[model samples]
Target: MMKTALHSVSYAGVWPGQARLGLDDFLERTRNLGFDAVMLMAKRPHLSLLDYDADARSRLRQRLAGLGLKVACLAGYTDFCLGAERPDIPTRELQILYVRELARLARDLDCGLVRVFTGFDYANVSLDQQWGWCVTSLRECARQAADAGVNIGIQNHHDAAVHYESLFELVEEINEPNCKIMFDAWSHAPVEKAASAGFRQEGGDLVAAVKKLAPYLVHTTVADYVHRPRYRYQPNLINYICESDALRAVPLGEGFIDYKSFFKALKEIGFDGYVAYEMCSYLRGGGSEENLDGYARKFLDYLSAF
Candidate 1:
């Protein structure tokens, strides 16, 4: 059975000009929304290591117990090769330490997973070198998490392992029992550039990607979005032309993504982990507490039906 979870980023108001709800409020809101668990943003205004000490962790655990909520995972923001821009920066070490501390907190909170990311590509570094850095750093992170009895999920949200094959290679390279893919339909969608990265031989085939990567999937974060074509006006030419597609978040099953196929694949593969919902970006309805709660419930109902 797949458990439903809500990411607190939906309520953190991290985006500018959005409603700011504290973590405690977010927890209570999630419980009211009827989720099985929650995936907390492991940063400020939430569960930052600097803010969460031993006593704080204890208090948080008690609060969750009272609310009947479980910490599904901790979302750790990291860019392993970000320091490549300036050799003096110890970004790799800092990120590793960050994950280590999150792992400790996960243990204290009785959570089993911490979600992490690879680095974006840097102009100053070769792609392969960036890949090597991520592999090495992720190995250390996996070791640290394993020591704390927590699992680390590598989300395909960064350039280093954005493609399905690249992400699979990353898992094989790390070869840690605790390291697994937090796969989602968005990244697995084969687009024009997927050939070079090996997402799928055929493009725009998300179901294939899900089926292919099913064995290594431990968690998945989901949100739906509609693509509005971006048009630019050339006043001199008196013509408007399409530039790109502006993705706007919508209630589940209302976007361009074929989530039915994606979820179907997960079910076919017997994926029994958390299916997390998030509104981490600009939402269709403005970010009000009522709107956020409404969207979260929409997602909950969608997952229940799915």
Candidate 2:
């Protein structure tokens, strides 16, 4: 059966006005919210490598066991192309080391997955070089994670492999058994919307895209969004210049995303994996404890149907 997990980013205070909860408190809240598992942000104010030592990991594992909450995955932030312009900085190596430590931490926490990202495109570097960096770095991360019995789940959040097809190709090129895809619907919803408006793009159909990636998908994150239009007033011409619509996060089942098709596809594939809910941006309602908890509960209610 599919399971529901809450991501700590929602309450990590990373976003403006979002309530920040300590790691322990977040875990307790997850249990209180009735989520089957929890996805840790794996950084400061939560599970920072510097803050969590060997003893800390032990205590955290025990706490989760006590709460009957499973660790779904550790969210690892990485950008392989971040310092491509300044190769002297060893950014790729540092990120690899960061992921390595995360793998060790995941092992210590008794978690089997560590979610990562490919790099964003840099102005000075060619896409080929950035792709190579991501592939090489992810391959190494996967090799190391394998030793710890952890898998590296590459999320389609960054520039590299942002498209589902490219993401699939990237994973295939990485060629690591332990490396898998952490697919999400919000990432593809925009593309599908664009495709409907005569924009050419792959994976425009959410169901087909999900089926295409179902074999490699090990984890997925759920979030809903609605586009808010923006325009720049051109006083000189007495007209307004249209700009891209700003996406605002909203409660599940309330946004423009077609979660019915997305979840239906996942069900068709028998994706019995973690479907994590994350509030990673400024939300529709204020980010108070009451609103956040209400959103979280609504997500559970939304998933109960599937």
Candidate 3:
């Protein structure tokens, strides 16, 4: 059966006016919210490597067991092509080490997955060079993570290989057994619609994308968003200039994402992994604890249909 997970980022204070929650409080809130699992943000104000020691890991593992909550995955932030111009900075090596340590932490916490991201496209960096950096770094990360019985999930959040087709090719190039895809509808739905239509469209071929990545898919993060059009006043021209639409987060099933079709495709592929809900952006309602909890509860209600 597919499980539901709440990402700690919902309470990480990354978005404007969102209140911060400590790790312990986040875990308790997740359990109280009726989620099957929790995705911990592996950074400051959550589960930073510098803050968690051997003893802390043990205590956390026990706490999860007590709450009947499982650690779905550890969110790791990385950009392999960050310092492409400055080769001496060793950015790639440092990221590899970070993933390696995250793998160790996952093992200690009894979690089996760590979510990572591909590199962003640098201004002066060639596509081939950036792809090579991600491939090399991921291969090493997968190799080390396997030793701890952890899998590395590459999320489709970065510029490089953001498309499902290119992301599939990138993963094949990495060619690691433990390296898998953490595909999501947020990025692809917009891209697919833009590529197909001359302008931005409402929905995309979520079914096809999910089917394509189903085999390698281990986890997925879900969020709903609505497009709010923006325009700049052109007083001289007596008109307004249309700008790109701004996406605003909303309660599940309230946005333009074709999640019904998306989830149907996952069921067809027999995807039984954790489906995580993340409030990583400015939400429709104000960032109060009551509003956050209400949004999270709505996600569970949304998933119950399928």
Candidate 4:
């Protein structure tokens, strides 16, 4: 990653769900990784809570300044329970309020993005209701985040509203400069008109999906993937790119993302954001800290190709 210094956020591992390391160890490790920044996955011990605040919060803040690591984004998975399956309005509103609290903490730490989501309808609700609720929610969040000078990012999760076309529509509907699609290359290829019409694979170019998405990609994250043998690539790297089912994390550049195309579009859009190296399988098998560190380094190196 020395060839390409990037501000990054890691979700595949590090500061994970129910991590036993607490905040100090997490920040200390992130600083040691030579990562300029870190994104706290705010599931538990969210740095905003003052009570029972693990000394880790204060300690992590000190370590960040001491180590010169920038807190980049506070990655949170939040919504208004707009989905029919989990329609809990009061609870989701409270969660968003909690996220705002986290944003205040992030501002104190000098981070940038508070990555959240548009509630899922990936394949469920009627497009009208889905887009309506999604647009309204994002616009409000954007207004709030803008007032706070924090950008709100909508993660492209694959449930309903986040499907390629659906998301494009949502972004267009919201039309908030503060709200943007945090393009995740691992998500589904944009649904082609032909595909939506049920004749896509017949002749539609899959690469077009990335083109369709690039327009709204205000934030970019670069990862690794390998192409299929059919592509005739060297080292078996850069073979294919696709999403993962296990933990929903894809190894960087191993699927069909077409980074060349992605990078081209990114440049066109002028995306100057975190290229989070969020690769998976790096922390499996109870690897030693040194092993994980080395693995992280190598992945970082691989990511420098862009």
Candidate 5:
């Protein structure tokens, strides 16, 4: 389908503490919230290895089928390289083997997208050496993933991080159309020229970042927002796009992000993927259904325009 879709809000936007309900409970509520599909997170609460076990695997598949929710992408977070401590042949080979195996499993699960991580640059580390390891690892991952009919979704996270240009460089050099990047809006917003429409800054814009990175835009996130006491900007339980507004982040649309063009760009690029509302809200500590439903409806309407 050329049209983009929304993953079930049941997917953890982050880790363990974020959820108030159990997995099954959340999935039911998420369906009621109107999400069309669901994207699993790469970390705890929804481990990547869940794709391997037959029982756990079968149960997940059956549940989604029963609920009519499609599996959009597996949000896995593994560093392709284990670092120079394992610079030698055997260690490196083992690392590659494990990930390749995981990629194969993801393919078997019919999850075409797997989001891996780019490690942060360390102090005193030479750019060439660090990047050399990263580049080699990603290319190998891409090759194996391609063989498995799966694509790598390189996710963005700051600190010992991979800069936007570096990510672009990696994808371009690898030259595998399937090797894509998952731009976490929080990480992505600052890296690009800030969208001039609503926010101003010497900092980069979210619009420009997404545009420059659009060719490889594998997944995107959204959320609800509200003003915070600090007041420079709102902070939700999580804000997928910014830290500057406050140490506390807000939900989608409730913050400074203008997703009109963000959604438009996906449709323009023919991204047949889910526009997940990354949970920076987590049901806002148990608010009214009217509140959650209103946000979901409004956001869905906003996205459907494109």
Candidate 6:
């Protein structure tokens, strides 16, 4: 059976002066919220490499043990092509080292997976070069992760290998036994759109997409969003409407994402990985401890139904 885990990001305030919780409190909260496992956000205010030393890691491991909680995975925030404007900076190297260290941390924490991203495409470099950078970096990271007895789950949250075909090719190019995809429905919304618009390729629709990607997915993140339309007033053009879509995060089962279909496909594939819930962006309700906990519990309720 697939396990349910919560991402620390759901409680880690992203905005200034927002709700903030330390790693310990976050873990305790997860336990209180009735989750047996958790995915730690590998950054400050929660599992930052800079913050945790040998002693700190020991204490965290002990705490998890005491609480009877498991570390599902370590979510690493990385963009391999970050410093493309300055080739001398060795941005990819730095990111690879970061992921390597994260793998070590994952081993120490008794976690099997270290989640990562394939860089974004906001650089001046060509797509081929960017893809090459990510592939090389991920291969090295996967090697180190394997050495540490950990696996690397390349999340489809970045532009470097965003599409399913591109991501599959990238993973094949890396050719690491320990490397796999951390597929999520939210990241494949564009493909769903194309499928809805009569694109009939195999696995073009959401259900088929889930089935096609299931074999490669080692982990999946869950979140729901509802689009809020926008309009721009134009004096000359009779109020031109904005083409861009705005999405607001909502509690599970309350958004536009057809998670029932997605979950059914996952079940059909016999997915045996962690299904993590995250509230990383602006939520439907205000961000407070109570609201966050309420939403988190609601996720559990939603998952139980599945």
What is the C-alpha local distance difference test score of each model?
Answer: 0.86, 0.91, 0.91, 0.58, 0.61, 0.85
Regions of model 4 farther than 4 Å from truth: 1-20, 45-60, 82-89, 122-127, 189-216, 222-251, 279-291
Tens digits of per-residue lDDT, candidate 4, 1-306, equal 222223223323444441244566766676677676666666644343554254656666677789777766777666544546666546545656766766666665676678777665445567676656666666777777776778777777645455566667777888888677776655544333325557555422324545676666655555543322233345568565443223322344444456666665555655566666553333443434554555567656655665
Predicted candidate 2 versus true structure: per-residue lDDT over 105-149, tens digit per residue: 999988999999998877888889889989999999999889888
* Per-prediction TM-score to the true structure, in the order listed: 0.94, 0.97, 0.96, 0.70, 0.72, 0.94
Q: Is candidate 1 or candidate 6 better by lDDT?
A: 1
- Residue runs of model 2 more than 4 Å from their true location after superposition: none
lDDT of 3 at 105: 100
Number of the top-ranking candidate, with lDDT as the measure: 3
Best by TM-score: 2
lDDT tens digits by residue: candidate 6, 3-105 = 8999999888985434789889999999999887999999987999998898999999999999889998999988888886787898888888999899999
| lDDT digits (tens) for residues 1-306 of candidate 5 | 232334333344343344334456656766776777667654445545644477777786678778877667766555543455645556455656656766776665567887677666665567676667666777787888888888887777633234566667777876777789876655655444234434644335455566778888877655544333333343774444444433234434555455666666666767666776554444553344455445556666666556
Candidate 3's error at 152, in angstroms? 0.3
Q: What's the C-alpha lDDT at position 157 in model 4?
A: 63
lDDT of 2: 0.91
Off by over 4 Å in 6: 16-18, 194-203, 236-238
Where's the lowest-lDDT run of ten residues in candidate 1?
A: 187-196
Model 5 lDDT at residue 155: 72
RMSD of each: 2.5, 1.1, 1.9, 7.8, 6.7, 2.1
- Worst 10-residue stretch by lDDT in candidate 4? 1-10
Model 2 CA lDDT for position 252 = 96
lDDT of 4 at 298: 67
Judging by TM-score, tell me the better candidate of 1 and 2: 2
Q: How many backbone clashes does candidate 6 have?
A: 0
